[model samples]
Target: MDLIAPVVLTRPAGRNAPLAAALRAAGLAVVEAPALKIERLAVAPPVLQVGDLCVFVSRQAVDACFDGRCAATPWPDGVRAAAVGAATAQALRLHVPADAILAPAEGAPPDSESLLAVIEAVGLVPGRAHIMRAQQGRDWLARQLQARGWSVYCHALYRRSPAIWDRDTCAILAGPGRCTLLLTSLEAVDAVADSLRRQAMDWPATLKLVTLHERIARRLQCIYADRPADALTVRLSAPDEAALFQAILASARSA
Candidate 1:
């Protein structure tokens, strides 16, 4: 693995500003080829009951939900909001108070499991809850909440369409350097792999991957198993941008 390879940013355009800036600050070449184009859905917001819980799977969820259907509607007085991680929690704070938001316990992993643990700790055992996210987001959290006897209302706030493979995106994937791809979502990883195939390039052979979870890594392995060159994949301990940069630097130094 070569250190300081060109890093491909696959996050949605609206959400990649901070991470892209940080990557450039670390002296790595960045290719801004978004894998998914987020489109807000035209849906009616559900009324919240007292003691109801609302979960935002990602920052995009918060933005899509509030900026679309719930633009003028205030959050119900006794309803509480929850986010999977600090970034999403920060996004929630833009529309709701810090005290009204619930998140994974500080120092705990920022994931569905941790968020579920926190919800259970706060005595949110049963009642009604809402899960706001992309159209085809993972359903594990919603299923868990339902298992706990909560009436889970899944609101598809946005739709994630595969991004078009423009000339610059094609060049980045087919470039000569040992490029690295930053994949934070499984859907984005699949879109990128499909994009490479559509561009007629041998994908993942000379490319390294920085994925947020082992599930995404497993998916990549399935995609690149037949390829000859083994790609280096680094999985971070956390999903935040700080941990992502640290993992990138550590991988670079070790290489």
Candidate 2:
């Protein structure tokens, strides 16, 4: 397969750079058009009484929460950290001790549901849990914890919003040949759709979309419902860069 389609990396700006560089090293032309702009909220972590497990929802959340002075603060003893995926776990582990970090079990899907199951099996009695993530992110996990009588707090460490595109971004999306979009979030799916609509570019019917989860793919399916049957919507089992790049290469070869 020729695999000449320009791959669009729709992760937030700083986060997209490394992935774009990696993709370029792999010989694929990359369009660095971020669908979301991540702005860290100027807030500090509230003092915990004890036994509160801080849950980081994404790597961005980790950066916002602990990349700076937050890491300098004395980490309270007896508090644990939880991450929904390996990437988030790695980020959390940078500040918290590895033994204090909880993540989805090996071989299980690296997602909220799987992490929740592991938390259940670990028998963490109803207590306080804080979910650190972007503003306006999903509350399903928090609700699940709450159902079990855990007092859940959602700390919006960063703000995520649709990226304001320039003329170059419009040109790239409207450029020649088939394009594959690597979208990692549901908000990103909507952002791309909205950007395309606003730009009034004729999106290629044969475009391929790679999403991190099935729910994002379902949203894309709705957005691109008018497309022809051959258009592809690929969903990876995990929401990480490695899985995304692998899916991209596989789909490109198959296409």
Candidate 3:
């Protein structure tokens, strides 16, 4: 039988447990090397009033928004919460009613474009909209909302810094063993590339990457352009955990 490669999960710190557990249960060796460390910013959560639309850019945004004082207050009735992806939507459910949350259809690419479609379908008259997000990120969604006549307000709830890999983790990545790296965001792709450069390590010919979006895959392709065409492989998967699991498993088996 062909040997399966170890999977390296590069999500933010504290966010890899569930996926790592799932992969391990399926008999795959897992490495948790967070590409980004999330730091909650000292920002007050926006007040939700009726007819207001609150958008969360990521699950971390949702968590930071409702961490303290925000948790004590109930989500106002008639206020709609929007999530850029299913995971973010799930997080929002803890603070808002399920019905009050808007998200893309099942299996649709979990992205700002997808969420914008869902928001448009509801024909929500352009009104006050608040976006809870990190210190820096793509402003596509906010720009789109503003173009639609929505009074968009942005709240920075957290900041992301590149994580430093430990010696053991660095050894694994630089070792000869087959490995598959999972990247979920454009920032993560850059973080991983930066980390590898810092170690003066080249992309292992046997290494494969699985990313959640075409844009991220393209970014990876650009970053590793100096490597031989066949030295690195990039695959795209849906944002959901199940899809990511299958993509990682397939990449491992392909080795």
Per-model TM values vs. the true structure: 0.87, 0.90, 0.92
Per residue, candidate 1 scores C-alpha lDDT tens digits across 78-144 of 8899999877997888788788899986556667998998888888658888898888988999888
Tens-digit per-residue lDDT, 26-103, candidate 3: 788898999999999987888777889999999999999889454468888989999998888878888889999999
Clashing pairs in 1: none
Q: What are the lDDT scores of the predictions, listed in order?
A: 0.78, 0.77, 0.84
Pairs with backbone N, CA or C atoms under 3 Å apart (clashes), candidate 2: none
Query: Which stretches in model 2 have alpha-carbon errors above 4 Å?
Result: 68-70, 235-237
Indicate whether candidate 1 or candidate 3 has the larger TM-score: 3
TM-score of 2: 0.90
Best by TM-score: 3
| Residue 215 Cα positional deviation in candidate 1, in Å, after optimal superposition | 1.3
| lDDT at 154, model 2 | 92
How many steric overlaps are in each model, in order?
Answer: 0, 0, 0
